[model samples]
Target: MPARPPARPVPPAPPPSPRDRLLAEAMRLFGERGVDAVTTREICAAAGVNPGAIHYHFGDKDGLYREVLRLPVAELDRQLAGFDDPGLSLHESIRRFIQPFLFDDGSCNAQLFFREMQAPSPVFMETVAREVGPLFDRFARLLARHAGMEQPNAAIHQLAMGLQAMAHDYSMTRPMLDAFHPELLADDPLLEQTCHRLADWGCALVEFERQRHASR
Candidate 1:
């Protein structure tokens, strides 16, 4: 009787917006093919939805790509924002930050990240450099801190670029894993292991850089 006095309202199911569908399709296609190779029609075809969806959602191909990349970039932003300056040790700090770039978000929706990594669109690259680039620079500082480099300007920048190169392999070589590094193929359990290992390796690289600087 008490519950009947105030019935709970049913929550509405979230409707998929036209833009959302198009962006999702764009991510899938872009992940499969190089950015230049993915066409609008192809995106529409793969989406199994109307061609106009892209126009309605994003106006143009570049717009669609930006929308797609926003997902991963947003996540990157959130993780970086939560960086605790005091609590994280050097190795822990590097591993925590680097995992998102290389591993799937436990949902396997890593297409947009892979696309950008493969062929870095000028528009997207500029956007990242302005926004996420600072985050990477900050993370590079974390690496530098562990490496004991007081001034990490050039050295840490190189490490940041190296981490990016390593992450791209997950999407760049989806098939070649059949013959080489099959265990390391992203589809298997090995990928998670690989990401952690790479984090350690990245930290090690920074450590070496720190040593060089210290020696000087």
Candidate 2:
């Protein structure tokens, strides 16, 4: 029998670097005009890639939105490694979570990260829960514990939702803060103040829960 010809050398596929690529573009556009104003063309323009790239890579604008949001979510997860603080003080755990979003020694990563969360899309919100739920849920239990609540209570999750609501109040209005309250919103000042405020707000709730838990 004749020997088979040598197999053609297969080239390794190009790197998807699209995650970072799309993220950078999404951040630029979303940060500039907010999410609704910026179209996929703008994202592609900022990204210096074809419009098809976004569709080819992320399924659609919403998919790209998920990927954009995921960057920070994944970053948060990395910083939170080994944070098995199911029993950690709720206020402190909340503080740790808030710190990453509010502060970054690096350049625009922090600011860009925050905009996505601040100006959420419905699509982003759908994925956001699944992506960030467990970590925040653990913090919910910690909050309940700090308030001396027993397991299986709805209050714990509600408290978690409250924390998000509060943070979102400040974070979602960040552009307004920067424009109308620039000094307070300066990254340095905001980062510093946000960390303390988040803890203070969280701790304040702990006291409220304590009373409620005791009353029951």
Candidate 3:
């Protein structure tokens, strides 16, 4: 047999760009410590870049924090795309809207969101209004359509908020669930079952509101 040729060594992977590093480190630090507690210097040190990198990449720490905040919102928007489709059944709409929360990836973005909920930065409300508010409004409008309202009212908005709170609870209370009921987290089918049950309840609630509105 002919001698085998020597294998060529693989080239080293390229290092993360300074911008990517800054974003990643900022996400970690902001998620763990909240934006107020974290500083530009700490983020730069963790990213292994100079403090100037933040300004170059994101203008400043506030700019970086805003970008970090948007990461999860972008993911949410992707997941929630088409949730308000007119062709979807009300149950499916509810399911689609809430499913992301149940099967949350538990990424750093989620932690950052939780941190923001607990202690929002100056940018948080503005960001939510600009990005997340439209999503919520769309869901509310869907609910109104099912409930026979010309538009979403205060009651419809309240209902939308309540459903969101329920979905968030399943994700946000995961740590407690893990400590007390580990099997719940481990069971995907069980989570799906719970999601379906919630969807059914949501449908019933909408029907009830529809009847109530009709009677008024």
Which lDDT values do the candidates have, in the order given?
A: 0.70, 0.71, 0.87
TM-score of 2: 0.63
Which candidate should be chosen as best, given lDDT against the real structure?
3
Q: Compute the lDDT of residue 161 as modeled in candidate 3.
A: 84
Poorest lDDT segment (10 consecutive residues) of candidate 1: 103-112
Writing each residue's lDDT as its tens digit, candidate 1 over 1-44 gives: 45556777999989776566676777777776756898898888
Residue 187, candidate 3: how far off, in angstroms?
Answer: 5.0
Pick by lDDT: 1 or 3, better one: 3
Which portions of model 3 show Cα errors greater than 4 Å? 1-14, 177-190
- The per-residue C-alpha lDDT of model 3 at residue 110 equals 81
Instruction: For residue 97, give model 2's deviation from the true position in Å.
Output: 2.9
Q: In candidate 2, what are the lDDT values of residues 81-135, reduced to their tens digit?
A: 6544665555567777666554444344455545556676676677668888888
Best by TM-score: 3
